[model samples]
Each structure stands twice: as C-alpha cells, then as structure tokens.
Target: MIVAVWTISAGTVMPAAADADPPFDYLKVMRAEQMWKVADGSGITVAVVDSGFKEVPGVRSESVLPGVSVMSPPINDPDKKYPAHDDVEGHGTSMTAVIVGDGTGGAPKGLAPGAKVMPVRTSLGTTMAFAAGTEGAQGIRYAADNRAKIINLSWGDYYARDKIRDAVKYAQDKGALIFTTMGNDGDANNSGNLITMIPGVLGVGALDETGEPMELSSHGPDTDLSGYGGKARIRCRENSAWCVRNGGTSYATALTSAAAALVWSAHPDWTATQVARVLIQTAGGPVDGAKRNDWVGYGVARPSKVLVDRAGEPGAPDGDPLASPAPVKAPAPSQTAAAAAAPAKAAEAGLPWQWPALGAVVAVGLGLGFMVTVKRRRG
Candidate 1:
C-alpha cells in the first residue's frame, strides 16, 4: 500500500500546524487602545484575496462568510463545484489569521477581531500557472461588488496587468482601501521593481519591531509605508507541529490592513480616502530630517497616534494627507542595508507559532481537505 505524500516546504509555503492561539498581545503596543478606541470593525467587510484558507480548528468557521471561488479550476469547464475555499499554501490562512483570527491562547490575533472576513480564494503556486488570466481579475471585481470595504492583497506579481489595475480601481471607487505587499527581493535591486507603484495601490514594505526596514523588502519609488515585517516569522501548517523563522512584506501589508480595520470599525462613516490619510499623517517616518524613503515610504504606520487624537470623532472624509507630504528623497542604496539590521536576531522571538489542539471534532476528514476544482454554481 502506498500513501500519497504532500510536503508544505519552508519559506515557499505556510502550513496549518503553525497557527497557534494569538501569541502576540496586541494590547502591549502603545497604540493598541488608541487604535481600538475609535473602531472595532464590527460591520465592515474585508476581502482576503490569496490561496484558499484551511478550515482550521478555531480560525475559520461560519463567521468567515465564504464567497464564490473566482479562479476557474485548472481544466476550464463551466460546471463544477469548486472545493470549499481552503488554504493549500497556508499563506492565505496566515494572512486571514493576521486580519481576523480570534485571539485565543497565545495565537496570532488580528488587529480587528470584530470585523467580518470575506474569503476571496484565488490560485497560488500551480493554480496560478493555470488560472492566470481574467478569472483572477473577475474575482477582485466580484469581491468589490459584493461590498468589501478593504481589500488586503498579501500577494503580487512583477508583470503589470491592466485588468488587475482596472479591477483595483473599481474596488477603490466602491470605497475599498487596497493594500499590497512590496515584493520580497529588494536586495537584488531589480530595476523593474515598480510592481507596487501602480496608481491607486498603497505599496507596503517590511519594518522590524524597533521600527526599521528589512533588507529583503523591495525598495522602489512607489513604496507607501512599512510595517512589522521582520525576522520574527509565523508558522506553516505542514512539516512538524511548529513554524519556521521567516519574514517578508506580505506580513506588513496584512498588519497594516488590520490596523486600518480597527480604525474603520471605530468610524464606520469615514471614507477609504480618510482612512488612508490618517494612516499616512500619523505614521512614523525617518529619525533624521529626511521625510519619506522610497523603501519605507511614509515610514512605519503609526495608527495609535492617529486614533488617539481622532478617537470618537472622524477626520475630514475627503482629505488626502499623503498628497501634500514633502517630496521623498532617494536614500543612498547603502541606507536600505543599514535599515536591515533593525530586525536582528533579538527581534526574532516576537512572532510565536502556536499549533491548534484539534479535538475529535477536527478528526472529521474536512480538517485538512484541499479543493482543486471549481463549481460554476452554488446552492
């Protein structure tokens, strides 16, 4: 008898076993109350577009309103019930955890636990190779039309596609604050790294706990702001009952989006533009006189400060704070490397990986199921 073997390798993919209870106490952050004071994100909807999320023990459930699978299965057919969206790669699940995971035991808790998560499962890895066309864009449009206030995109590609930009614009018009990760690989200094700079998209970079940049975080003229995307890594569900040490801009983008949710939930009346403005104006920038760095953009997001002053009261709904920031100065290439030291070995322990204790309930076959097909119709 032969058993099929599937490996969720390190760095390349995240496994479900890594999802522990909310490990980091977001309350410890100085701005925790200020950010949470204004909004709990109770009624707003956030769309997570990435690998399907796994139906983990406590993470995902009826609370996560399951949206339709937009990525047509590899074999282009009109009629097939796409497997319920589950995270095959764990990346999507991790992002979801960061966005809305109920802070259980030391598990990773999202900034806004009260917000509703609209799961928009798209293809990753092999699925991308097959369904890279209009299907993904259509999925984005579908999520926007369905009423998602914030769209958190922890994934991105180098090749600029007009379809994606159009879809993003549509979502923005519908009042979605779109956030995307600046691709990992800035150390290589790829000349064509403007993937995050496309108009209307807020490109995010990675910063350590001490508020410094990470080297692997891509730097370009388009970067918007940095977040806690440091060496401290999250867990993957595969391999052992633990997670590996890794960091990237993907984490930063999700963190910032969740932070935005906290604010939006507090002031449900604020427009996407107002949310973006408050974040930029309140963010922590360079220590020196320099204003904004291409790598860190407006600098690390400082939600606590923003929420503190504007708590219980909404700021200008149409104000655009980021528009008036002094022109950003290009830091010497050497500055990025120096900033990398911020997420040193010491900061590594901050991100903890907790494996869920699956009761007999999880023993159900659905616990670790993967759906590779797409059904055209849903009951």
Candidate 2:
C-alpha cells in the first residue's frame, strides 16, 4: 500500500532574494494582528506532523520542543544520526513559520506567535519519502502522547488505513484537535477520499484574498473551514532572508491550526471540541446568508472575531462539531455465516481500502510564477 504525501513547491531560492518585500500581508486580512493583542497562543503546543522544521529567524529554538522522526528505513530508529527537527525539504519550516513565527529579522509574523511548535518528522530527503501508513500513524500517536493541544497534518492522500484512523481516534480521545488539508486537486466532489474524510479530523480548504475559495482548492462536504492559503508568505529555512509565497490546502490547514491554538490558549479550560465549535460557529458567513458550502465550508476562519469580539458560543464541551450521521447497523448474521460475513459487511460499510500511488510522501511549498527564489536544504 503506497501513499503519496501532497505538497506544492515554488522552486529553489538564492540568499539575496529574501531581502525583497512581501507581496501581500495576510495578517491584516485575517485580522490576526488585532487578535494578537488579546491572545498570542501562549502555552499551546501545536504538533507539526510534516517533513520537519528548522530553526529560523522568526522560529527560534526556545519555541520548539524535542521531536521524533517516523520516516521509513525504520519507523522509530534512534540510531539515525540525522536531526528529526531539521527541515530537509523546507515544507515543514513554512508551516511552522505560519504557526509560531515571532516576526524577528523582518520575517512575516505568524498567527500564534506565543505558541510552541512540536516537530514530528514523518518524511525524509528532498523528495519527502516515507513508510506512509505506518509512519503517519506513529507520528499522530506520538504527538498525542506528548500532550499536543493541536495536531497539524499538512499532507494527505486518497488512501486511508485502519492504523491511521485508529491513531486519529486516539488523538481525539486524548483531547487533541487534529486538522488536515482537503487536498489541492480542485475536484468538485472531493468527499470520498481518506484522511480528510476521517472522523474527528477537521478538513480545511484554501481561500483567496477576496474571501472566495481558491480555484485549486479541493471542494467537499468534509471541508470544515477555510483560511488564507493562496500565495501566503512563509519562512524558507533558518537564517534565510527570503520567504516564499506558496498556496495550497496545506497552508490553510496550518493557519487554521494556529487559529485553534490561539483560541485554546485564551480559553485554556475549554476542551478541544469546544474550541472547534467556537471556530465553526464564529466563522464569517457568506454574504448570501448561506451557512455552509462545499467550496469554503463554514466560510473563512475568523479567529479575531472569536478572540477579540468574544463572539461564538462554545455549545457542548464534548460534542463533535463535524460529526456525521450515525451509520445504520446491519443485522447480525446466523451463527454459521457470522464469521464469514463480518469482514465483508465491514468492507461494505465504508471501510477504507489501500491503494498504491507514486511518491511515498510529499510536502507543500511555493511554486513558480514568483520572482523570488527559495533555497532548500536536504539531509
């Protein structure tokens, strides 16, 4: 069973390009700057389960926790000398910057500057290859065990495994809110895929500056909310002056994770479910008064409204905001046929089947069409 991790890269960069000014200011649009005055996501730990993370200008070591690697060659090989927190593909660095960057050295400020990042490396090398199912499941469990308040999965695939589903349930049981991308395929009916369709995980879609869904952002009923995922600025690597303008559902997931962190930090007593509910209820509705849509889910995530204005009602502490209707139970088979019928019935009940795909793992990054270049490091 092969699973490909999806990521969008803008290309390589040189040192001098970092000096250029940013093309857009996402903080102003999302009202993150105003929200920061009330809460900066302090005391919240967001587990970035991606390629890895690097110590950059805005992302300092004090804000990062010791993390583990679940990449292939070995699921949890302690003997591997490579640093688990290092970003070989620069994808994790970008996501990390979006979550906790401190805006030092002229870098763009992150949504939750006071938050701490827990890096969980699940991919290796520049190509971001890994033992997809095993490593991903291990990574999720590790983040939950480490007491992460939020888990950010910036990568996803069409195939879903029982191990991964069980791991997601484990995290939810542990009170960790999980967020994942809705993919970049731009398909109209993107609901049948794995990862995003998994119960208890919030699927995020990308939104452009105009508050409409990005043309490339996947649309599906599973998309819980939208965020600024188009051409958003993010740090490339440690000690780099240039930030890349990349767009994908991965960025949406990261930004939403930061928003969750902010809400959780401000209301430390709130359960993961309560925080999720606030985000959904307080999201900016469309001009037409339509509460929900597949293209942008509940609408653009407006954390500032929740934090600054104290808007939204966190209904039930333990209620799942994205819970699907209960599945109908099939009648039990006769004693003799029960054993043979159980597996088939479960399969027919929407159990995920493994499918092979090229590229065992992938991470999102900036693509071409921009003048700035991004320099990447591989270990």
Model 2, runs deviating above 4 Å: 1-3, 8-16, 74-81, 124-130, 187-193, 235-241, 323-379
Return the lDDT, model 2, position 169: 87
Model 2, residue 131: C-alpha shift (Å)? 1.4
Score each candidate by Cα lDDT.
0.57, 0.66
Q: Put down candidate 1 lDDT per residue, 27-102, tens digits, no spaces.
A: 4553565556566667878787766566664364754777766656545665754543666667666677667776
Best by TM-score: 2
Report the C-alpha lDDT of model 2 over 29-99, residue by residue, as the tens digit.
66776788889999999998877877767677887888887776544675655466777677787788888
Q: lDDT (0-100) at residue 284 of candidate 2?
A: 55
Q: What TM-score, to 2 decimals, does candidate 2 have?
A: 0.77
Alpha-carbon TM-score of each model against the true structure: 0.74, 0.77
TM-score of 1: 0.74
